[model samples]
Target: MTEAPAPATPAQGGEGLGDKGLSGKSLADHLREIEFDPRMIGMVAALAVIWLGFDGLSGGAFLTPRNLWNLLVQSASISVMACGMVLVIVTRNIDLSVGSMLGFVSMVVGLIQVRLLPELWGFEHPATWIVSLVAAVALGGVIGLLQGALIAWLAIPSFIVTLGGLLVWRGAAWWVTQGQTIAPMDSRFRPLGGGIEGAIGTSASWAIGWAICATIAVGSVVARRRRRRFGFSLRPLWADVAIAALGCGAVVATVMVANAYALPAGIARRLTEARGQVWPEGGLVIGHGLAVPVLLALAVGVAITFLATRLRFGRYVFAIGGNPEAAQLSGVNTRKVVMLVYGLMGALVGISACIATARLNAATNSAGALDELYVIAAAVIGGTSLAGGVGTIAGAMLGALVMQSLQSGMVLIGVDTPLQNIVVGLVLVIAVWLDGLYRKRLG
Candidate 1:
């Protein structure tokens, strides 16, 4: 009877079972074959749920154009720092002092602009903003270098070095202005913090969106061609097309949302008057396309993503993280890479400081208090494993958005400060737990 049994049909798991057809593979199988990161899918789904839940609880206020626009601006600084944190975590290092570093650098920049530069260049001098920014960034890099040196050259642990830095820098920040706040920053510099004047126009936003879409499409095609030329395994053409479509669609949707958020009537009227145009019977509806800080964050994300994915330095960092002894034996300059990663993290923190100071129009010793937690949480939530050698800049950026979204949503629902902290702490713990499970499954 066994010898006489019929051969297994395709439906019963024969060769054609793996074929790409309705009769063979299910949708889930097709998705699996496309090699999409399941974690990313889960994150996106979770974000959708959060948004929907918040919008419902907030009586539809959470998803409005104005709220969304403000949310993006608020998220800008955290997103910027998270980009660098991805690298720091990727190399098995931590920077507890970033928040304090941000405060110190911001205080210094504020002093230079508000109290020092005006004395020399006169009020609102064009060069004041540039000089202040450069100095702030340089100072941040120097601080990072010092801390990294202590860790790398002295063979001290990063946790100890940065923990000391956290205290030292916070005290330094207070000392910069003797616990006073610096205010009324340079006029040109204020836009970096993203008020009504900080936005690029609707036309420019659309142009940028289109350019990004074109790049995605072209890049996908080039990647596919390169894979074919090198005889590497290729994703299905349909998968590539689907990915490109989704990316372009997202860009377009974002641009549209930004363009939909209109300027305040008074601001629009004043702008028209300043331009020597008569105010129409109906107020002009000028859109706040995209904030400068948001654009800066985006640029950082793109640049960091490229650096991490396409550079020798990045490879060395990851190699060191994967196995430090092996990487050192293989001739990787592990110390140099580690030092450089921290330096880069410091530079990013500097940028975040500027954005925060500009937004508030003031800098205080507490400007970035607790921000290190947010940055680290964003990186962790975005899939930067604490075990190191596994992370993505895009994921980190998305994670920053998720973190900001939660806080913003909580605020809208009138959640207390302590509760917010508790929630954030819980989220960070859960993210790490999930990451451990993911790693274990892979192992």
Candidate 2:
């Protein structure tokens, strides 16, 4: 038949069909077609609702710059740990000891800085914070390594091993100085916890924001070029541009909000006096830009994202999580990767401990108490599957923010602590149930 009319070439028929299909799709279907994560969109929408609801309930106080800034700061330590938790959970492991590990590491850091280092380096020595930080991180890594070894090499279940570690580390924390609280951390170390003094100024924040925007734009171009070179599928040019624009817009908005929060007049005056500068007649409006702890948390998130997405180790971790037998048969060093993942988790806890201790200017056995619950809840809420091989650094960080927002919002509205715990428990259960449903749908 006239050679079947050349089968109505795909360009002639397929294009129209595709156009019709797209025209009939909903916004969500379009987003899915673009390969965007729907869970992320849901989380963002939920966060927005939470913020607006809390703001209304609190008479507009919750959305104020000061409260928002403090919320970011409060989320920092948990976010840092959640990044590590993503890796741990990805490989089908759990670390219940993170909170205890944090407590112990912080206690040791406090002891080193306040009691031991002062005897050797003297108080406020520049090296005190550095030495303490290094020691704490090392200790954390060692603890993690030991726990990982027991799980990987000895064939012990991770839950049992980490459970033991939880008790052991908590007791060790209490034994360190016999449950005494240490206070007034070194002057230099205090900035890590994030106070007015711990923030970068408005100019610096703007500079950083613009720099990040430039990086996002450049990265998008480079990625597109790479894909082209490989002859791989690519997103539409508009999609790429939109993604970069959204990222840059977020950075710009964050910087703007940070810069909008002016310091109290009394604090500004005292700060100026300390700097040997005269106070302005009407008082100065100094913006406490990005907080140090928040910056550190963001940096950690970036580094972990790169590690998980770009490195062979990260690939191995996911492979193991997806199918341990297959990964092992494929020549992956499953044991070593598992052990290393734990060690990395411990190191992150050390960083978190430093932030927490610095923020409170003290370390107590109770420091990081119940933190494990928060960390796990955050990772889970962020879309990390407890079953394995499903998580993202950015998602976990966002999850941490969501958890913090819930707690903060409740506290702002004067909810009782018990009620707060009940709310968090319910949220955790709901997140797990939702995750199960999402996974089932995907399957």
Candidate 3:
């Protein structure tokens, strides 16, 4: 009798052993088509490299719990602004005036909080903060609206409009402040920036971290269920589990680091003295958990992501960026969409200004100088396309973190200021160049 021939494997055109057949395409093709977001993966790897590089140079000080916590806090403003900038870029528009807008709005906030409210009422007005917050955000939006209108209705290029606003707003800020600094910001506002006196404590940190993880898991489950109801392809169960597990791990790691550096020496001593207790030889009190500004950034990121991914407006943005004529033909109201994008950006600018001013506990004429460059770099480095129709809030957040980490690491490594700027500028250029090459490949 002739020996039985063995069945061919997947490579030989037969399905692989125990193939599920759920994937309609051939195994190889299915593997190739599997969804994977490279931007975030690359960002995480880049961040890891930065941490390792800086740790080595700083003798491990760079990754210390305190330093890492401080890093997150410091990056919060840039991160918040980047969230809004993502939408702007996705619509194929750029706002060079964000830095100037921030400075100008911050001065307005300062005038209300430090001078106008107090001087008018002789004592801090009870409702000053409430009114100031509204006014700041609204004023920023109006500025953006005017600039966007010029671009949309008058046929002015966005670059030109925002560039003009950049000069105009900065000059306005300088004139308002007269080159002076405004200080003694509101008590309630300080905590929003995660100042030393107003950060979350240890318990709250862990709670917030775990809560975030839980919320993400729930959101994932809901999304999966909705997709299934619509008969969309669902990822394997293992993938969902793995993703949730990774998110939990990340949150736990962040909380652990913050806990490790709970209290600094001076703060510990003050606590001990206040409690009338003898301080231990080298022990420090646990100061606090995650900073408030980090939480603010997280909240803003969540809101922006929802707006971008779940709304018709966001869909219109991508459509317009991809093909303005087609989008207009589809009744997308291209001009209004672009205008709303810039308007939203202005509001975010106001928010970022508030955060930065609170952190410094002062608003200076130069508070946001060069910040527009940093914000744009964050969005680009986070994987936003300059040509539009591509970006994510998550990517922008990670990009802001990367930029801040580089700056902080450089400071620790004692790199010269000029050299640092040169390095950052090169990174931005390289990022844009790589993106261009990527688009060319697709073409």
Q: Please identify model 1 stretches exceeding 4 Å from their true place.
A: 1-35
Candidate 3 Cα outliers beyond 4 Å, as residue runs: 1-34, 120-126, 265-284, 438-443
For candidate 3, lDDT tens digit of each residue in 1-443? Answer: 01122333333344454543333444333332334464566679989999999999999989888889889999999999999899889888899999999999999899888888888875456677666777778988999888889988887989999999999999999988797889988887777677566578788988889898889799889978997898877776777777788888998898888777767678868877898998888776675778888888889999988888899988898898888899999888999989888888988888888889888888887888899999999999998998888999999999999999999999999999999999999878987787677546433
TM-scores for every predicted model: 0.92, 0.93, 0.88
Best by lDDT: 2
Query: Against the true structure, whose TM-score is highest?
Result: 2
TM-score computed on alpha carbons, candidate 2: 0.93
Count backbone clashes in candidate 3.
2
lDDT by residue for model 2 over 1-443, one digit each (tens)? 11222333545544545332323445555666666788898888889998999999999989988888999999999999999999999999999999999999999999999999899868999988788878888998899999999999998999999999899999999999899999889998988999977888899999999999999999999998998998877777888898899899989988888888898889879988999999989888999998999999999999999999999999999999999999999999999999999999999999999999999999999899889989999999999988899899999999999999999999999999999999989988987897788757644
lDDT of each: 0.87, 0.90, 0.84
Instruction: For candidate 1, write residues 1-30 as lDDT tens digits.
Output: 112223344253556553334345444445
